[model samples]
Target: MPALTAPAKRLHAAWLASHAEWGPGLHEDGFGLLPEDDVESPAGFEAWLERLAADSARCTYRWITEGELVLGGIALRHEGNNSVDRAGHIGYGIRPSARGRGLGTWALGQMVEEARRDGMDRVLLVCAVGNFASAATIERQGGVRERCRNSGADKVWRYWISLGQPAEGD
Candidate 1:
């Protein structure tokens, strides 16, 4: 079974493998990776991890792993910062090879529990309008469609999940 684990140095190589699968970009969500994050080098990766640790008060980051292999990442933003406003309270992504296995759905459900434990009444989740898989995952978690807005050339769909209620698949 896949479990959510904190970002650790021991998973550097495994993380790199997963990063490679996404090719090159800062588009990988849920990891909280920033533009300045250098995850390719061991030292740089450590620095990035340290940065994430420093921001733990504002966000929670985790990796979905089955043993030593990294399958994906999930992040829960605790504070209502600009990121939370734009990207929503949660963001996640599964590795390409791990797609279609319900890993995203499972990970998202776990994160919702984490949010509830943190005392949040609800969370906002946004996905590209074209991303049916992500939309489905969020909907399965009892996410209600709020509105759709334009972000550059892409349309973004926003949903809200109330923690007061049980998730659909739970």
Candidate 2:
């Protein structure tokens, strides 16, 4: 597996498709939440990148890959994001074609490791209430479900994973 890298031109097709599929909301990876409008075109995406690259941005963004093929992305927020409450410190997603494999779980572990390195004792993750796959991924990483809360129009299950503990399946 290759190390995390900044979003680049090569990932356009997959990134766009991921955005299209996700539809109408922020694609939260450890970096800051990406507004749907921000990625509508090459120029917009570049502008978004410019904003994220700013030192004042509170999040770190990275895309996971295997060689030149992008697998997924993760974002780690250094500052508390007001959108999903203070607990939702990380967010990630795999492309549609990459789902069902263990990539989500793997990527999440890597993200948690990043958090631990940054001195976080625990981190919060949330998935749509019906998204059992994501809940399972979080659970595999030692996530303990806290509760389901309504956020905007959707209800999400919140989980907390302690960095010092080992995951149940990994």
Model 2, 1-170: lDDT tens digits are 65677877767665666666656666535435444546767887777667767733567778877676666788776656564363377788776677888888888888888788777889888888988998999999999999878877888899998887545664
**Model 1 misplacement above 4 A:** 165-170
Best by lDDT: 1
What is the C-alpha lDDT profile of model 1 across 1-170, one tens digit per residue? 99999999999999999989999887789999888888888899999999998989999999999999999999999965568878899999999999999999999999999999788999999999989999999999999999999878878999999998556675
lDDT of 1: 0.92
Inter-residue clash pairs, candidate 2: 29-75, 30-74, 30-75, 30-76, 31-75, 31-76
Model 2, residue 170: distance off in Å is: 17
Q: Which stretches of candidate 2 lie over 4 Å from their true place?
A: 17-40, 55-57, 84-87, 165-170
lDDT of 1 at 14: 95
lDDT scores of the candidates, listed in order: 0.92, 0.74
Clashes of 1: 0
